[model samples]
Target: MHVPDGFIDAPISAATGVVAAGAIAVSLRGARRELDERTAPLAGLVAAFIFAVQMLNFPVAAGTSGHLLGGALAAILVGPYTGVLCVSVVLLMQGILFADGGLTALGVNITDMAITTTVVAYAVFRGLVKILPRTRRSITAASFTAALLSVPAAALVFTLLYALGGTTDVSLGKVATAMIGVHVLIGIGEAAITALTVGAVIAVRPDLVYGARGLEQRLKLRVNGELVDAQAPLEPATPRTSRRKLWIGGLVASLLLAGFVSFYASSNPDGLEKVAADQGIDQKAKEHASADSPLADYGVRDVDDARLSGGLAGVIGVGVTVVAGSGVFWAVRKRRSTSQAA
Candidate 1:
């Protein structure tokens, strides 16, 4: 959920800002180990894909909708550290450009939505992968379970944060109950989306999916009725061109989703918005600072056609997020190379 301004006080907000910054700093270093020539480029595509899928909010309840949080999906496709950066990029783009999230509350959104989700999801995924069979199906299953739990975990973290620095005097217990209940349902949608997307990628290019790495069983050959390990003779390692193709394909898919398919997303309020409206927690919600931006509210300024306006805004968002995310990841990749050289 994109927490708007005035929901949390200045002190707690600033505290979260520090925490978010520290987390990003740590992730930048950890992502160095996760990113390589094959994964660095895909990391940017994963961010763009998450941005696109988030635009398609699906109905969860009678008046509530949910969208892909992307933490598990990104972590499964790339890695945990990179996943945090991916979601952070999307939240930043939405806040500053689309006015979807508030600028003042950027830290809250990043901490709760990006950091918490990625940590919890990746932890669960690793744990499951350790116990489950090492196969693509097992990886997908683990991804689904991790994604399902991450949403509610994030809701709980937010509720705790609100309890500590809530602007209103609402009952913390009631807020927790409502937030967790609604987000649990929302997590089902998150799991399905995460599983399907991870499954699709694993099917096409398991080599590119970080979570699926080492999950493939070694092939065996029958040599004169004896089973023999299929190991190739020593040869010079070939560069991965298939990964580049996959990255290009993923970027194109993200463009298509945001540019055109986003028009069909459900118009109903999302899980957090619905809970806030019902729980009276949104009483002090402040206007977004970027509300005056031309692309505010996911619509182009002065575009009379609802479809065209929203479509253009979505496309612009995809473009900005990809550029921003790619820049950050590319820098991280460069630092990684420098460190290795040193």
Candidate 2:
């Protein structure tokens, strides 16, 4: 969730800021091992796609809505460390450019949404994958389960943060129950999206999916009574679809979702926003620092048509996120290559 300003006091927020910064620094180093030439660009695209999908809020309850939290999806597609960077990039873009999250509390949003979700979900995913089969179906199943749990876990984290530095005097027990309750419903949506997206990619190009890599090599055939490796091809099997084509298709899907489908997204408050207003969490909420930006509130300034304004904003967001994320990943990749070369 995008934590706005005043939900948490300055000291805790600053503490979270340091935590976020340290996590990013470590992630940048770990990402080098994860991102080579083949997967580096795709990692950036995955980040942008998450940004696009997050704009499409689906109805969850009578008044509450939810969108893809994207931790499981990213972790399944890309490595967990890179997954953290992806969501972090989206949060950074939203905070600075779209005013979706507050600048002062950007660290809170990153810690709660990006770092917490990715770390917890990926841990769950790895544990499940070990016990379950290594088939793509099992991967998809693990993704769903991981995503389902991650949202509530994040809510619990927020409850703890609020208990520590809440700006209001709301009941901590009530806050925990309510936040976890609504977020559980949101978790179902998160699970479905994560499973479907991870399933689709694994179906098309399991090689491109970071979490599925080892599983591909483990595919075996039962011969007589023993498990044996599948016969290796003398030559590499020709890919049915080119990486360029897949990239193009993914980009198109992202554009369609954000540009057109987003217009139909439920206008109700999302799980966090709804819970905040209901639980008195927003009693001390402050205005976003970038509220007056031209692209604030997911709309272009002075655009009369709501649809066009939002559409343009969505497109611009996708473009900027892709560029920024790619730049970061490619630089990391280059550094890795240089170090190896030297």
The candidate that wins on TM-score is 2
lDDT per residue for candidate 2 within 1-342, as digits (tens), equals 789999999998999999999999999999999998878989889989999999999999999899987877887788999999999999999999999988888888888898889999999999998888657788899999999999999899889989988999999998899889999999999999999998887777777888776664355788898998874422126656677887888888888888888999999999889989888999999999898999999999999999999999999999899899999999999999999999
TM-score of each model, paired residue for residue: 0.93, 0.95
* Residue 299 Cα positional deviation in candidate 1, in Å, after optimal superposition: 0.5
Relative to the true structure, candidate 2 reaches a TM of 0.95
> Model 2, clash count?
0
In model 1, the runs with Cα more than 4 Å from the true position are: 216-241
Question: What does the lDDT read for residue 128 in candidate 2?
Answer: 91
Write down the worst ten-residue block by lDDT for model 1.
232-241
What is the C-alpha lDDT profile of model 1 across 1-342, one tens digit per residue? 889998988888999999999999988888999999878888888898999999999988898888988888888788999999999999999999888888889999999999999999999999998898666788889999999999999999999999999999898898999889989999999999899988877767767788866554446899999999775422114533477677778888888888889999989998888888888889999998999999998999999999899889888888888888889899999998999899
Model 2 clash pairs? none
